[model samples]
Target: MAEPGRQEVVRRVRELLARYRDPAQVDGLGDDEPLAVLGIDSVTLITVAAELHQRWDVTIADDAVLDPEASVASLAAAAVAPGGAGDRPGGRLDVVGMGVVAPTGHGVPALWDGLLAERAHRLPMPYDAARGHRAGAVAGASAAEVVAPDRLLDLVCLAAGEALGGLDPGRRAGVTLVVGTTDTGGNALGHALAGAGDDQSALAGWVAERAAEKLGLGAAVTVGSASASGAVALGYARDLLLAGDAEEALVVGADTVSKSAFHGLAALRTLGVDGCQPFHEARRGIALSEAAAACLLRRPVPGDDAVLGRLAGYGASSFTTHMAAPESAGIELALRRALAAAALAPGDVSFVNAHGPGTKLGDVAEMRALADVFGDRVRTLPINSVKGLLWHCQGAAGVIESLACLLSLRHGTLTPTTAAEPVDPQWREFDIVTKPRELADARSAVSVSCGLGGVNTAVVWERA
Candidate 1:
């Protein structure tokens, strides 16, 4: 293959930019001009990287486009240079770092505090009693505080901003933005069309456009499922990076409860009358809640502070397991698959961030699956749930829980699974952490989540 020089890289980037720019802007574009000045946001920049990767196998770092000194020539030199960091085996595949936006806290720091303190944010449902569901809210923050009015897209944007903090904007912009939501802007739009619902496609479009704008990204895409949205987002991010499509990707998972979601859960009789009580002997059902979380991912790079944990493996599976009830088989399959992909055994996991929503069946099924896969290891590994603090944020649960898992690895502490009196009789062998415990040498953690539609996703993270 012919090596590309700085001039060649510049020529390719300019061509990609031309697709979305005004003819005048395209003509005015110069090698030294900032891409943002030419209206090249993060989404468009990723498009450019995709095009370049397809044509020249060039791997651009997230900061390349944002750097003032990163001229077209310099970018080209980096892209075409043989044995460049970007061209190395691990160059295109790094977790570099992650960020979080959850109920217990806003960023990773706050999350760590909440976990260490063993705080519980679960509370009675804020909506009308007639709605028939309680929830575990993120303490003080309200939907308005976390999101813009009737703008679910804004919540995603806010989460993305928090996740990208302390990172180079130019480098961040170079990656793709993939979001996961059970209900994208449904909470806001549902209220607007209480009687007659609006077009779902239009709502989706608005969310994507607004999120892209907020993040200064070039493209915005979303994946939806009941609870597995977060896992799906990570899985997709990994795929994109591994395909050499982009050097960096931002994966965000967010969702808010509304009348629609509340009623739907109530209709299924899965709504808890009080707060959620995962693994409790007297567990009733789940309490719907709201949450948003974002993670910054890149091809692994050494010495990146943002990299709290390296994403080692991901597994997903779907089954026709009772549509209304939990499915142990599918959950176990997903967990096993993820472990296999990571080339790890069940014993390798030191902690499990269970998708405990405080529901009787849901919690039981998840525990059963854990026992099935981990066997004797289940008795030794510490396990906890963030639901007692954040409630069940639908699509956002996985990512929010992931933030908790990452914090656990970084802080060497395990958050107690609140409201869980003891390991359910059915789950006798598991070492469910009812109180916070000191975690040492905690190098690896797993996050597991199961969605309503039989979607299950598991992700393994290793200390970086």
Candidate 2:
């Protein structure tokens, strides 16, 4: 095979650019001028590189893709060059450390043990109208923990401490904190409403600021995308690292079960009476729980042995069709985009950590998306949901579930969907895991999360 003419390559590059930028702007660009001159952002540059690989079977180096000096001429030359791989849009982030506090237990090890052993602390909802509906509550945490600001902060600080323990104390100053929560300042508001605390702004980002202050980290940001908050925060932190805005990012997802959250889900008739049983025929609904999880992410350093897994790529989407129910198309789009960004095919995935919240509609929509994306592979592809084990931690669900993926990568075992019996026949196409399964040398896995308001997120992970 021969390289395309320089003129043709330039034309193709410009054509791809037109999809993300104004056609007029792309058309007016000079071949040899840097793409940055046209105000092309780093993300768009990576997207263009991925498109180039998809169209021409060639890949540019990630450095070249992000280079401010690189232009259409340079990109075309790289495309025509031989023997390079991986110029996916989001690149990858090394998950050097992780921590978690859930109903199962504290820290990653305990959480892993509990998940595999099917151990959870279930109790009745404290509220009167809850009608003895049980949830996977954190064992030592009180039912009113959500209304206690210090308690919630303790959860964040504890998880962050464990995640940051391996890093040198001097390096903490360079780390940025990105926290995800559905109820940011809801605790403070709850206290205030009860006349137990002074009036203060209950902003969504307040907890992030508090956590950063406590952890002695750099700047902080918060993401509150319902149940998908954690994955979104991880994605944002990855973007910051990819764009050279942060040396390291500490992503924390912490949420406690609160009265309002419980009543809201109850009002929606999405609360489980017994416990979470994702993908089961007798599944009721979500069993809301409390959890906090933290992950330390940074650019891969050569010869670094601390890495547990690699965040190869992530993608998110929001469908405006429903406020509560999810749309399969949006979920499918996020899944497809994640694989594309990671330069992975559906068949390359070994297993999946799903967002199965146990509700019939939610599970049905997610299964539909999976079947569409993976096709016949769904029949054999090992898939499992942690909701049955950890329950739904709302904003914290994404990170806790993603941590399950990292564990799977490190241990080469897929954790089971605890007590998920009588599997839903409608989803018989999917190989839902009920017992621990060996990974058999597979390296890549995906974690999919869907939240209220039709928000969906997917992340690809690789064993380090």
Best by lDDT: 2
Highest TM-score: give the candidate number: 2
Q: In candidate 1, what residue range of length 10 has the lowest lDDT sum?
A: 85-94
lDDT of 1 by residue, 268-306 (tens): 888777566778888787777666788877776656555
The C-alpha lDDT values of all candidates are 0.70, 0.81
**Cα misplacement distance, residue 222 of candidate 2 (Å):** 0.7
TM-score (C-alpha) between model 2 and the true structure: 0.80
In angstroms, give how far residue 415 of model 2 lies from its true place: 0.7
Error (Å) of candidate 1 at residue 230 is 1.0
Per-residue lDDT tens digits for candidate 2, residues 275-347, read: 7889999888887888899999999998998888999989776653568888776687678768877988899
TM-score of each: 0.74, 0.80
State residue 280's C-alpha deviation in candidate 1, in Å.
Answer: 0.6
With candidate 1 superimposed using the best TM-score fit, by how many Å does residue 154's alpha carbon deviate from the native? 3.0
